[model samples]
Target: MKTFLFRSLFGTFFGAFVAVVTTISIIYFGSIEQLDSEMFLRNSLGSIFCGWFFSVSPLYFEIDSLKLPTQTALHFITVTICYFVLSLGIGWIPFSFPTILLILGLFLIMYSIIWLCFYLYFKNEAKKLNAEI
Candidate 1:
């Protein structure tokens, strides 16, 4: 219970941090001309939820019956939907067929890179632990 609460709070804070960073990046790149308070608030909240969901997504691996590939695919699909919808709502990506496919392609590439990094790191750590044992 305590760990769950910690993860929840940590996820929320992490989400907020990601949203702020994203806002800064957008401003730095001048992607948008202007952002009124209402839109900013909505986008910030949406981004926070996106980050929170992404952070907690690994919990899906806790399901004993699901293999690693199944967990990975489920997590990927769920987060992709969450991110795609949030991006559309926040105007980060336009609503068009080509643009949609582009965004998804980019997301898949990034997700795969991140997943591989984590997998390799954990695999190394596991090997080290086994060697020590």
Candidate 2:
């Protein structure tokens, strides 16, 4: 619980920092115009919550009773829902069916790639530990 809270706080602050930097950089580079203060705060808070949830998302996998696939599915679903909502709230994505589908496809691809990397890395680590044993 303590670890989870710490991770959440760290991610929240980290997300806020990244949000500020990224937003400012875009504005500075002429990629986007400066947002009014209210929109800026809304977007920043959305991103902060995103970071907090994502940081502790891996904890779902820590449940020994659930199989890996179940854990993955749950984590994927929860993250996707939260992120889609956040993106809409932050005005990063529009509220439309086609755009939502496209975004969902992108999320699927991203999640698959990340899951594969973690799976491969952990398998390698297990092999190393077995060899030592």
Candidate 3:
């Protein structure tokens, strides 16, 4: 439990860092002129909180040895639900079914790509280890 909490703390810090970078990049590059500084700050904090929540929440899942497909699916579902609910709760996204579905679909695609990349990287590393053995 101590280890898990430590991991969660590390993950949350990492996630917040990523979120801050992302927010800065978007504000710098995307250059949304309509949002005031206060609004931007609020959005940035919301994103950081979301990232931290997401990072820490998944420590409870026991899916390390699960099949790749099952693990990916579970992660995708869990993240999507958490993100969607958070977005709605924070008014980051409007509470509309169609919009929610659209965001979910996009998130599914993004998560699938992420899972595939990690899967391939780990599989290759395992194969290399086996070759050495």
Give the top-scoring candidate (TM-score): 2
| Superior by TM-score: candidate 1 or candidate 3 | 1
- Model 2: residue 1 alpha-carbon error in angstroms: 0.6
> Please, what is the whole-model Cα lDDT of each candidate in the order they appear?
0.85, 0.89, 0.72
Cα TM-score per model: 0.84, 0.91, 0.68
Q: Name the 10 consecutive residues with the lowest summed lDDT in model 2.
A: 30-39
Which parts of model 1 have CA positions greater than 4 angstroms off? 21-35
Whose lDDT is higher: candidate 1's or candidate 3's?
1
Q: Model 1, 16-117: lDDT tens per residue?
A: 888788788887898777877887798779877876787687788778899999999999989998888888978889999999999899988999999999
Q: Local error of candidate 1 at 103, Å? A: 0.8
Residue clash pairs of candidate 3: none
* Model 2 per-residue lDDT tens digits across residues 64-105: 999999999999988988898789877889989999999899
Off by over 4 Å in 2: 31-34
RMSD in Å for all candidates: 2.6, 1.7, 3.7
What RMSD does model 1 have? 2.6
Model 3: residues >4 Å from true position, as ranges?
18-45, 57-65
Ranking by TM-score: 2, 1, 3
In angstroms, give how far residue 39 of model 2 lies from its true place.
Answer: 1.3
